[model samples]
Structures are given as C-alpha cells and as structure tokens.
Target chain A: MSEFARLEEKLAKLRQRERIAGEGRKLRGKGGDALLAALVAEIDETILPRRLSLVTPQGPVHLAVANRRLQALLAPVPGSLPEGLADHALPDIEDPKLAELGQSLKTLLAEAENIPVTARRLDRAFGSDIGVPAVQLPRIWTVAQPTAAKPDDILSGFLADLGDAALAWLRIEGEEVTLQGGEEAAVAALSEQAAIFLDSYFGKFDAAYREPSLACGTVIAPADGSANAVFFVEIGEFSAIIHAPAAQMPSIASDWQRRVAE
Target chain B: MDITAELDAMRVDVQGCALVAYTDLSSQLVLSTSAAANPVQEEMNALSQAAHLALDGAIAEGAAVSWGGETPAELAFLMTGAEVRLFLRSPANSSEALIAVCAPDVDLERAVSEARATLARIGGQG
Candidate 1:
C-alpha cells in the first residue's frame, strides 16, 4: 500500500510480461519446428510408402518419373524429419491443399515456417508488416519513364527504389545484383520488378557483348537487418551498380572511382 | 606518389600487369592505365568495373548483414580466369581502391604485396 511497495508491484508485473513475451517467441519457434518435423515425417512415413507401393519391384517408368519429380520439388525441405504430432497450440497447415502439397510443398512450408522468422527479423528492424499472403504476388510492369542516363544508372535507381520500399539493402555489380535483408515478400517483389525492368531496358539496346551483359542476385541477410539486401547490376563496358548498405557504399564508390581515375 | 605513377610502378613490379585502375565502389572508373589496345581496352574497362562492383557488393553483405553490429573489414577480391587474374583491394579507412589485371600465371601473393606497398608509398607521398 506504500509508494515503494506499489512501485515494486508494478515492476514485478512488467518483469512477468517480459518473461511471457520471451516464452511466446520460443513457443512460436518450437511450434514451427514441430510442424515441419511432422510434415517431413508424414512424407517419409506415409507418402513415401504409398509412392513406393506405386513403383513395382522392377520400377515402372511412369510412376518412377512422378516419384522423382516429387522428390525434386521437396528437395529444399529436409529429407529427414522426426515423427510426432505437433502441439495444436499454434496454427497447423490447415489448407486442404496440404493434401496436394505434392505439387507445391516448398511454397507451403516456406509460408508456414520461414514467414515467422522473416516477420520477426523485419519487425525488429524496419517494423514492416510481415502479414503477407502465403505467396505475395510477383511484380509485372513495364518501365514507362525513359531516362537519358545510361541503362545501368536507370536500372540501379529502380533497384534502389525497390530496396527502399522493402526496407532492404541492395548491391549491384555488373550484371549481378545482390539484395539482402527485408522480409521475404519484399525481396520477392524486388526480384520480380528487377527482371521486368531489365528486360524492358535492355530490349532497346544492341548487343553489347557476345554474352548477356547483365546479371542480378538478392540475399536476405541474417538477424537485425543492418546490411539487409544487396543489388548488383553490370552494364557491360558502360557502367555497373554495386549498391551496398549506406556505410559501405560511399567507401566502395570512392575506391572504385579512384581505380578508374588512374 | 600520385595514382598514375603508382600504377606505372606497379606495372613494372607486378608481372603480367594487363590493366590497373582506380574506381568508386559503384564500379565507376575514375582513372585507368592499361596495356590493352584500343577496342580491348574499352571492353576491359567495362568488365573490370562490373567485377569491382560485384566484389564490393559481396563484401558489403558480409559486413552489414551476415555479422550484425560487427564492422566489416576491407576486402581484396581475387578472381582467376583462363586468360588473366583480376586483383581488387580496397584499403582500410579509405574510399578509393586499386584493381589490377595480371596474367593468369602471375604470382598473386607477390602482386598483391607489391600493390599494397605501392599504395602505401602513394599515401606516404600524399
């Protein structure tokens, strides 16, 4: 009832809440791992058996092909999984399509598992919404506004915009683009947009090299999102954009300029 | 002491020095010296810039992303191809960097050592 006692009581309540939040995060991770394990176990125990039964001891050509395709599709998921029913405390893969996951198991698993990790990372870093659909829509639009600057500059700017939108980082080198950090949906959106933009921009130019003169890559950086993403683009003998995180880009830019200036 | 002289000295000391350049992190060529002839020189210029940018991007990812909160170190990207070997080095605490195109069979260790030494000499002169 005294002032100090009341303050102590409030502090105890805050500590309790903190402990709960920490446990909640752990539960989310445990829940995800359990579900993934179950899926893997189901595939190994149930699906594998049924599919194997479809194959004769001598291996039928048609069934073998189907089995091989299924394996390939599910390759990204771990081949081995523990057996057990997941705790229903968190949501399970409720889609009836999970029964048809043979067609798109990877997408479903990524949606269920990776989203939580990505959302947590994005939430801590940029406060971006990770409540995206199981699969975010790919970008599809032509580059309408033409620029007088070289194609490399135009491409670099476009990628930078995508990075900004997603709260990610970009690095462009020659034809290769590296994008790191940000949520999965943001990175996917940027990749889709980059392809569309490059195709349109390069369509106007004559062959600069015998080989395709540009390439791009994206990488989602690990925890905390400091570096985030990178976008690299090569414009043949004309230009290249290696858009790194802010801290490094200036140094990289200056170093590159000095090298060429010599 | 200047970049031009340093590159000239590097060419003599480092065997198979086909091209030497100073570029920004974005792979923008600021200055260049090359043994490559007209058309080839032009092509190499573009390719080298692209290579530098790619290397820089990769380094940035490690520094900024993979190891969060840990400052990324300056990197030297060595790319060995069939015809030639490319060496890219960005000095610590400095924005400008030096990239050298050496012969495929060139001794990379020696080339890189000479490059750093030359850069040091340039810095001292400045």
Candidate 2:
C-alpha cells in the first residue's frame, strides 16, 4: 500500500482503541464518564489540528494523525522500510466493540449535558468554626467567696467595664482571697495588684492571709484575720483570677476605682 | 451573663477571629469550663485560624481582583476544603474591612452581597 494508505490504516486502529476506552469509562461511574467527555472534548476542540506524526527507529514518519498511541505502534519500524512493508506489520483489524462503546459513550455524554446544574448549597452554613464544641475553661479556682454584692451587681459592674459578656468567679482559701474573671489578662493584672494590696494591708494591720501564685497574677486578698478573698474574671473565651487579703478588701476596691479612672 | 451563648452567636458571624483565649481555639471549648468529649475541636480551631489569616489577607487587598467579584475563591488543601473570600473597599463615607466565609464553591456574587449585609449589620461600612 502507498504511504498515505498505510497512515490511514494506523489512524483507524487508534480511533478504535479510544472508543473502547471511552466505553469502559462510562461503565465505571459518573466520574469516569466526566473524564471521557473531557478527553473527547479536548480532542474535538484542540488535538485534531496537525496532530499526527509518525516515526520509525531512525526518524519520524509524518502522518495525518498525531495521536500518541498510534505513533508508539509505528515507532519500532526502521525508517528505510517502504510504505507497503510497513503496512504489512500493522496491528490486526479494529475491534468491533469499539463502535458499540463509542455509541454508548456518546449517549452518556449527552445525558450528562442535559442534567441541570444545580446551585451547590451546604446543609449547615459554612463557618470558620462549626459543630466543634466550645473550649473548656481551665479549672483554676478552689472555693467560692461570700460577697455583700449581689450577682446582678457584680455582673453589671463587669459589664460596664468589659461588655455584657464578662463573668466572674470567686474562690476562698484560708486567710487568702482569689479573684478570677473571663478577661484573663486583665483579671491577672488585677489579681497581682490585689495581692500587693493584701500584703500591704496585712503588714499594716498585723493580719494573716495566704499568698498563692499558682494562678498567675491573681490577687489573694485578706478578707479578715481568718479568711482571704479571691476574684475571677472571664470575658468571652478569656479568663483571669485575682486573690488578695480579705482584711484589705476596702483598699482593693479603692485601687480598682483608681485604675478605672486612669 | 451567658458567655457561651454570646460566643456561639459571635462565632456564627465574626470574620477572622484572633483570640488570646485560655481554652483551645479548635474545640471552641472555654478552658474555664470542665473538660468534655470532642475529637475534632483542635483541628477545627487550627483551621479557623488559618482561614482567618487567609480571609484577612484577601481583604487587605481590594476585593475586585483577588476575590473575582462574582465568584469567591475556594480553599483547598490536601485533605480539607472550604470557601472563603474577602472584600475591602472605601465606602461612600468611610473605609472599612469586609470578610466572608462560605461553603466550598460559594457564588462570589452572593458572598459579596452577604458580606456587605453583615458589615451593615455590624455598623461597619464598605
């Protein structure tokens, strides 16, 4: 056969292989069909333009199809061989299943195209954080303290300073006061000052109160000769504790007043 | 007084949260509360921080280019995927920041519209 005829024969074989592959893809899943469709689309839209080239052991043999599979089959033949001899070495006739597969693939692609493109919606709205449980605040307090101030009074005071979301917890230890709150940093700072005030009060009044630093910067105030007062603060997810001498409670309140002013 | 409820609400709307919280950022569990069962909390918090950073960066640059106005950008890592977008622009009167998070492949137009609405709701402009 002439060189042109030989090239045509090879092209026919490649088309047959592609058809079979396309059908196998359809049998697999939607994903497979999608892939096959994409490949066929590329071939139709892009690959057909001057795509084919043939080569032998020595050099290239320019053909009408640039398909890689077809080129690979022709690659082993020596360049000096005549077109007729090259044609004789070509693979057997194209598989008949290819046409059937090609028809099914075409039908599958048509169905996929006809399917409506629905708007993708999430069952639950997307959030940077979702379904995750709230964080657990550390257990840094030991006991609750009695206060002349009501819960509303304390909450209102905290709200005035740190928004409505603030919270406070108190723990009492022997001759020591600890205060904690949601605003850990601010509470910590207050705790440190409370401790200072308690120490100073005990020094002046000759009272006894425990000095604890386990809660960072929390003040332990001496409420009286036998007990101490502690304050806790929490602002949203943040928290802090303050402990001071119960005997020096009045002084600690005055200090808070002064700091708020500043 | 209900800090947990308030935080839950804030988490629903706030963009780019950067908390110096005493609790784990992932689980959203307040460290002050007693510990409980939660396997994915840590991973969630880490992802939130990363998402916040990504959204912040996008907003820092004007939304028109980075976000592709009609369609927001999608977040894709080796294992996880999410949708996030940012919009920062000068309003008719002032300058403000706008960031939004949506499911993967969220429509850009809708995200931008919702972000604008959120900013308005929160007293932010543009």
Candidate 3:
C-alpha cells in the first residue's frame, strides 16, 4: 500500500480500538453494580426466607460486613438486636451503589471473618498454638494487648491544634477519660463526664468493636464488633460520632481529623 | 449544702444559660432546677433519665469497649439546630449529672469550664 493509504488504515484501526475500549469501561462499571444487585436479590429472596426468625416475626439478623466495617443492615427480620442497635440499622444495604462498596459481598465476608484478632493477651501470655483443653467441655482464651497510642501527647497536641473547635478533649485512663488542658478541678469533672459516657456506651455494646474507626452517627450505630475493646470516636455537629481504632484515628477525614492531618 | 442555691449560682456563672438543672440520674428527679422558660416536671424527669442512659447506658458500654475497654467519654454534647444540650458527669460522683441548655452561639469552652467548677462543688458535698 502507498504511505498515505497505510496511514489512513492505521487511523481507522485506532478509532475502532477506542470504541471497543470505551464499551469495556462501561461494562466494568455496570458489572460492579450488577453484582451488588444480584447479591441483594439473592439475600432478599433466598436467605431471608430460608433462615427462620428466632426472635422477630420477619427474617433473621444479617449484617453486611463491608471489608472490616461491621455495618448494620436493615434486616427484614427484627429481633435479636438491642433497641439502640436496632435503631442504627441503615436502609442503604439494598442500594445498588453502596458507599465505597465496590468489592463483592463474598470477598468482604471472607475478609470480615479473617480480620485478625491478635488474641490481645492470648499470644503474649501463652505462645501461639499452645492452647489448653482441660476442666470439662474445653475453653480457650483469645483477647488482649490494645494498640491504642498514649493519649497524653496526642490528645494535648490535638487539643491545642483543635483549639476551640473541639467541645472537649479527653484521654481514657483505665475507666475514665480525663480531660486534658484543664485545671485540677476542671479535669476532674471533665474526666468524670467522659468516664460515664464511655462506661455507659461500652456497657451497652457488651462486646468490643471488631475493627477500629467505626465512624458512627448518633442515629446510625454500628454495634457488631469483637469485644469491649478500645477505639477512637469524634462526635460532631452532624450528630455523627465516628469510631475508629484508638491507636490510630478513623479515616473519615472530617473536622476532627484536620489537626491530626497536619 | 443548699442545692437550689448552687444551681442558681451555676445559672449566673453560665452565660446565656437557657436552663440549668441538678438531676439525680437514679431517680430521674430534678432536686432543684432553674430555666429561662422551665420545661414541665415530666420533661425534667425525662431529661434526668435520658442523661443517665446517654452517659452510662447500653451504648456507653459499647463505646467503652471501643475505647480500649477503659473509661468512656466524660462530656457528651447533644447539638441541635436550635440549641445545645450538655451532659456532664461529676467525677466526684456518677449518680449525678449536670444538664445545661444554652443558646446556639454560647461560648461552650467557657460554659464547660464554669459548669465543671460548679459540679465539683456540688459533687464535693455528696
């Protein structure tokens, strides 16, 4: 072929390839949405009916564990949930486009099952694979070693940077979160306030947060977790009290994290 | 100690204090309360109970675990479009909490400090 003819032929091929690639991109995006839709339909049709409700008249409690977040989905079935937790159930589970939920449910469930407990105290006290089975039915120990950063410097620095943006700042010492940067009396009273809030809040969960950085709202509570362990939270004007790991704050990146980011 | 006098004192200390109450979380009874436009008796009773639940209730337990199984938050402020409600647990005593309702634009830092001082005085007596 002549040089000009050859160039024209190459240009046509490029256009054709571009069209194919565009179509593929559309499919990839739709493919994710389609998968979530199918998953929702599968659970609504099969799982809901198959699993009889032990507590409520509807279906059984089925939470959607997105990656590490134990998200409370509005289970068609009712009972088996605390009143406060029940109130936290969000209606977005069935939405085709769940927030940042691009992964498949199968993958998320698998990850949720293997979030790595670290057995907090289990490994430290007794080395791995050395569990005992004595007494009777056999019991195992698995829970210990919090990775939360010491709040002293972090809280003070954060509070200083936060200045008046924060309503109050506190550091949890055992059973009380003593407010930082206050007089002896101010700290005492603030500490009491923080302690009572935590004591009452954790008391209700009856279990620790499975993963760190829950990022909870006042109305939308994520109650499903591992134990009554340590975590971080920021309650803001939006009425949202976001939770995350104590050692490190949650990744929400709202007003609270502004200082930490610096 | 004169509890009413104490609450009244707090009212004076707290600027733009809409209402101030010294509540017994256990009984949900307002021993002595002062408000610009006082809510009914039932409202105060409900406020006292709600304070207990929010500060030391089931959710607080979950929050405790999230906080490395240590003590939970001490000060919880309930924000709204119209006003702000603060719940402060006395370090000296857990059974009592000081509830204050203030205007939206009130100086919270100053308000919290003054409230803390007042709570210490009341809690000290008990």
- Give me the displacement of residue A60 in model 3, in angstroms: 35
Candidate No. with top DockQ: 3
Tell me how far the alpha carbon of residue A231 in candidate 1 is from the true structure, in angstroms, after superposition.
20
Evaluation by DockQ, superior candidate among 2 and 3 = 3
Number of the predicted model whose lDDT against the real structure is largest: 3
For model 1 chain B, the run of ten residues with the poorest summed lDDT? B76-85
| Evaluation by TM-score, superior candidate among 1 and 3 | 3
Candidate 3 segments exceeding 4 Å error: A1-240, A243-262
lDDT of each: 0.35, 0.27, 0.40
Q: Which candidate leads the pack in TM-score?
A: 3
DockQ of 3: 0.06
Off by over 4 Å in 1: A1-262, B36-48, B62-69, B78-80, B83-87, B90-93
A1-262 in candidate 1: lDDT tens per residue? 1312332343334333322111110101123234333223222211110121111122211111111011211112232211111111111233332333323322233334311210000111111121111111111111112112433454455444443333443343322333344555544444443343333223312211222111212221222224433333332222222324433432332233222221
lDDT tens digits, residue span A152-212, model 2: 3333364345432223332322212323344555444443333333332223211110111
Q: Give the TM-score of candidate 3.
A: 0.37
